[model samples]
Target: MKLVVGLGNPDREYRDTYHNIGFNAVDILAARLDAPAFAYDKKSNAELADVALGGKVLLCKPQTYMNLSGDSVGYLSRYYKIDMRDIIVLYDDIDIAKGVVRARLDGSAGTHNGMRDIVSKLGGTGFARVRIGTGFKPNYMSLADYVLSHFSSGERDLLKAACEAACDFTEKWIKGEDWQELTVTVAR
Candidate 1:
């Protein structure tokens, strides 16, 4: 089974925030697949859903919070006996411009605490990740507050487009498309 984990805080207040873009992307995928409703999984600290696409089974997780994402991912990954290579993490990145999506087979956590925790628990950075840019905030604002805040109207539109592109990239990945081609196609 392939696992697609979307990292974000779980709370009504975070519903439309930039940090929740990962969760939004997962929701888009689930919707496109006509997947069943998500059920709360205490062990994973996430909302879990299973969907079949192009003959592959996908396990989706919207982790409870950014910092604690690793706990959920680690539990589910081990439970399903899935390799880190079969897992893909989706999250927001402030370093890139809005409406952009970048994919990497493996890398350091960068500035994302969520990715850091996942690497710490997984024992390495051998998993794939899709990053959706949310644009950077001013130095005066706290990172936590900036990510948790709602996007401006313009940003929201750009975010929506990026999420759609992310879904397309995911579909290509599932089809065994080359990463270079997938990245180039999605970047457009």
Candidate 2:
């Protein structure tokens, strides 16, 4: 089974924040795939849903908030016996400009605290990941505050379009299409 985890803070207040782009992408993917509704899984502290896509695909959104995301991902990885290679993590990247999406089969966690925690718990960087661009933080604001800030209406539209592209990218990846060959950016 392949596991897909989206990293984000779990709370209504954080739902529309730039940092929640990962959660947004998974939600769009679930709808596009006609996947069943996600249910809270206490064991993993995540919301999960299963869908058939050539094989079983487990979609996950950790409920442990961003910094502690590893708590949920690590537990689920062990419980499901999912290899790091079969796991795909989606999260926001402030380093990329908005409307850009990037994917890698394996990589370092970089500046994302959530990814850092996940990498620490998993003990390796061998996993697929898709990063949604949230754009760089303004120099006047702190990183934490900027990430948690809500997007403007214009930015929201751009992000939604980017999320749709990410879902398409993810679908192709699951169906054995080469990820590098897929388009990774949405026209702005």
Task: RMSD for all candidates, in order, please.
Answer: 2.1, 1.2
lDDT of 1 at 162: 90
**Which 10-residue window in model 2 sums to the lowest lDDT?**
176-185
* Best-matching candidate per TM-score: 2
Q: Which stretches of model 2 miss by more than 4 angstroms?
A: 180-183
Could you estimate the TM-score for every candidate?
A: 0.92, 0.96
lDDT by residue (2-34, candidate 1, tens digit) is: 888887888888888999999999899888878
lDDT of 2 by residue, 40-127 (tens): 9999999999999999999999999999998888998999899898888888999989999888888899999999999999999998
Poorest 10 consecutive residues by lDDT, candidate 1 = 179-188
Q: Per the 3 Å backbone cut-off, how many clashing residue pairs does candidate 2 have?
A: 0
TM-score of 2: 0.96
